[model samples]
Target: MTRVSDPSAPRIAIVGATGAVGNTLIDLIEKRGFRYRDIHLVASARSAGTELNVDGESHPVRAVDEFDFSTVDLAFFSAGTEASRQWVPRATAAGAVVIDNTIAYRMDPDTPLVVPQVNAHELDRRPRSGVIANPNCSTIPLVRLLKGVEQRWGVRQAVVSTYQAASGLGHPGIDELKDASRAALDHPDETYPAKEFTPSLAFNVIPKIDRFLDSGFTLEEQKMLQESRKILGLPHLDVTTTCVRVPVVNGHSEAVWIETHGVVDRTELVEVLAGLPEVTVHDRESRHAFPTPATVDDPDRVHVGRVRVNPNNPRAFWLWLVADNLTIGAALNAIQIAEELVERRTL
Candidate 1:
């Protein structure tokens, strides 16, 4: 891959441009002020012909089947695993770097699963196959916090239980929550209407995110463990995860417990986390100070709070973190990867 010396020379394409992540990417691109020679938005045939107004210009959404990837320098895909499975090769073979927000290529040895704050150095070497996988939404914030702790004190074990938002499933998930909430008000004794995978999400939490394996862990839970190991370069890192779907519409929350190799004092740990870019430390004695799904505002940073060291184990610590799943977890991260490539002249 040859580096593009001029930052404004690279033409960009956002595949799946009508979906949740794609829309968020468009919003953040405007907010972050990235200059590109040209921008293309491609989606499925059903979403084609839709006009998206960005940077004061209306760009018509084109069908991916008709759009050519050869002229594009970078592509961000979030359609789904199946679409990515079929199109990523074409994008790479045409010389465009693909930052995929799907599970399709994440575990592929040739593809680097990345969370920028945790392992931006992985971007130094462009993928030989011209593809990089964005870590899972829940995994993104979890790993972001762990990176600081792991660097200051080696990580031995990590336990995370996620309170994932409906948005993780896409716009349909959001719609389901809204419809269910309205239905629940009159039919409190009956199950609310559900067309999505969830049966009832308005007033309840489902202990499942993705399909369960024989080992009983959902795919979402396993992604956190496996992706964390790959990004942190910890092959045997002990990680236990439980992923659940909650009624919230945007942000994702996590209750985390970590055991490090050395004892890191509470004050020092707070300072270290605060020093990391895009991470906010808000631990306080009052419960009101702790982070919740509603507490997440900026789409770029991870909010952390409720820090405490285990009384019996000096090496163990617990905390809560929240982040905008659609923004920082998906779109912002994919954009950051593309930005990193441009900054390093690897585009």
Candidate 2:
């Protein structure tokens, strides 16, 4: 990851620089020119002292405990939840504002779960704490698109099902799917059960995502239901979700049914989505120009397609949206929030 443009910040730190999303965070921070004078990189203790390049120069990873946050202004925490939980407060307490990508603080009433294109104002509103939580990758694009709709015309209910990519589970999950697929291909009968997922996820889709609750909703499904309403600031909005893990290595796709307060045109709806910033509408049914993981593997734009009204219900419309699970979903969102903080003088 290369740092772009101005090298003017007093101090900045990127915790967990070696992981998939963490590495991507550095790539974007550098790509967008969120420059810093002292750019500190941290990882687990074992990964300390390993060198990473910024602006083509080597920078060694530091132990988190050894990192002095007294002079740091902005810190991007892309580590796992437990690491974020343990160190984020320490950094923030030292006066560095934290933009965390983990789910650690997302549901906290005081901590705003931010998506720049959606609830950027939530980050703009000050007088709260120092840390900000980035929304889940699966939730980011889906919620961002929905937020646009909700602001203009109210939406009453939604039924969403995700064709989530293996990347959502991180590196281990991706490897698990790959290994399972290889075994299935070789022996056909001696297939491995999913190492990260509950069922086999190689060339197969698992209907269950995350741990199931007694309430019968898997955690992933529940996150979609809950995070959508929270990010849109319509807590009472009815939303149902079914999250499935697919064999794709990157990008998560969704099939969504939106029930609005009033009837709306399918064509106009596509137009609205097309016009929205950071979103690309691919609504072509004749040639099947719908959003798929292969088509939008690494794009920043959220691809939307298959715009159609439900034949049985005119008020309800079905649509498809896809986004890169690693970048746009988590790292890019976090960096965008950091960019917002700089623009709004929050950091």
Candidate 3:
């Protein structure tokens, strides 16, 4: 890999500095050592002035309303959808590249939905609106792992069951689990459990992730369907997803079943996946190893395992995949896109 350097390096700002994804963004940016003239951390006025250490120095988080994008060259927006909806246009109008990690602008035909490993070149399109939208958390890893298969078998359809960690729903998700657990153990006689989740998440499972759409699928499930197609440039691809919230804290896992245009053997798919750098294949018999969150939790590599065809379906393949939704799904992809931009001389 060649090191990227920007002689006139531009200042990079991270919106939502106090959020989980925001903290991950700061770590990834410094770890890659990307060239930047300065680093600015911005957040809501409530979080402003909070002290955080960056590159060994302590800096205070600034208020979003006080930021002057005129001086920043790039900004990563991990704030909620409402904030992105309100501020993205202003930052873009000021000539600063905005990589938004929200549902607000992802479906817009004018904004390219990017997963660096899958549809990074989509960023080369130079959106008329000037913002690049990152895919939904669960969709990012799934799309990349499927990329190798799509190259050979040409995936036609998919069905995925997700075991999403509580963090996928943000702070409220975590708090709900904590509150429910506390109430259950402490106040056993209490009538109601925690109220953050629609369903009790302490010891139960949530089959629904987001709001239900007219098609009867949750918003998260539909995001997987639509975002995967857009990132893969396969508009007509069929996708069905069951997104669930699990008790796990950080990593996201999926069981994917894909029908391809041509026949594919399980071993052949494993071979192709093992060879991909971004993908880690864990199908060992002696050690009884198969990809899991414990193995591929924080790395950019997506772990793939349990490769097998449906017992009767010869034209399809089934597999297990895992990755850190925080790293590969959001922060790392954003950093990789910036690096690619510099490499392609398109930054």
Candidate 4:
């Protein structure tokens, strides 16, 4: 955390400052005491003129089109894929390093798709494309644990099913879930029109997230596979996923089944996971010890539980994980990238 008053601190801009992840970014900057010479908040035209507070000072939100990218040293783009696609190049061209939170630049050959816990070394130098891409929410937690497993016992393959929250869609998605749930409870016969999630997500789980690919997997599922490969530097990694949207408002959970090349010892497995940077493993010592999205105490750390190796197949094991989609998945990762850049003098 650099001193805000220091003349050398970066001048930063937060695009999509009105959205869920954007708001979380502001909160984290305050909580972590992230310093900057100046901070600008930018959003769409509709959200312009609105005021948001950072470090107890009020700042007016500026429309992205009107804000000059050259004014900032670093810009974080979380608006959307289209927004990032439209504005990221402008920001980078203006000599501002961009940390993008969209899918636009993630798979680009020159852009680094980063998860700080797994690969902060990637930020040792300025990116060739002048932008760093954050991995998907579910992919972030999965890859963090996978890094440890792949090092301890070579990972043969991984199968994951994500129980993603409505917050994955941002603020509107949460509103729709609450409205749809209320409609269902008050009037059981009527259907609540679902805009964020198709066929309603109230008291229901939809197995499809994002759109369907020709290969029968949704785009969200595809992102997990592709992003995991890029972040871990495993091009041909066998990671298959089924992404589902649950009714919860925040926090994404995953049930992972990983088969390694060697036999796994449960005691050592727990120790390996527990030793990771910010992972908490709840073993099966108590009858009710696993972490749920609602009960997980820390939003910043990844929570893991249910450590059991298949007795029949000693090479495979099962684990459950929960992480805040907005924080660990999006804003927090973006800020951490900025922190790494500042520390390494890369930005």
**Top lDDT model:** 4
**What C-alpha lDDT values do all the predictions have?**
0.87, 0.81, 0.81, 0.93
Candidate 3 C-alpha lDDT tens digits along 226-296: 99888988889898999988877678899999999888887787788787667877883322567677666
> What would the TM-scores of all predictions be?
0.95, 0.93, 0.93, 0.98
Candidate 3: list runs displaced more than 4 Å: 1-6, 188-195, 284-287, 295-298
Evaluate residue 72 in candidate 2 and report its C-alpha lDDT on the 0 to 100 scale.
Answer: 80
What TM-score does model 3 achieve against the real structure? 0.93
Overall local distance difference test of candidate 2: 0.81
Candidate with the greatest TM-score versus the true structure: 4
Order of the predicted models by TM-score, top scorer first: 4, 1, 3, 2
Better by TM-score, candidate 3 or 1: 1
Which pairs clash in model 1?
none
**Span of 10 residues, lowest total lDDT, candidate 3:** 1-10
Query: Candidate 4 — which residues are off by over 4 angstroms?
Result: 1-3, 284-287
lDDT of 1 by residue, 94-211 (tens): 9899999999989889889988777888899889878999989988988888888888898999999999999998898898898899889978898865877466898889999889
**Stronger candidate by lDDT (2 vs 4):** 4
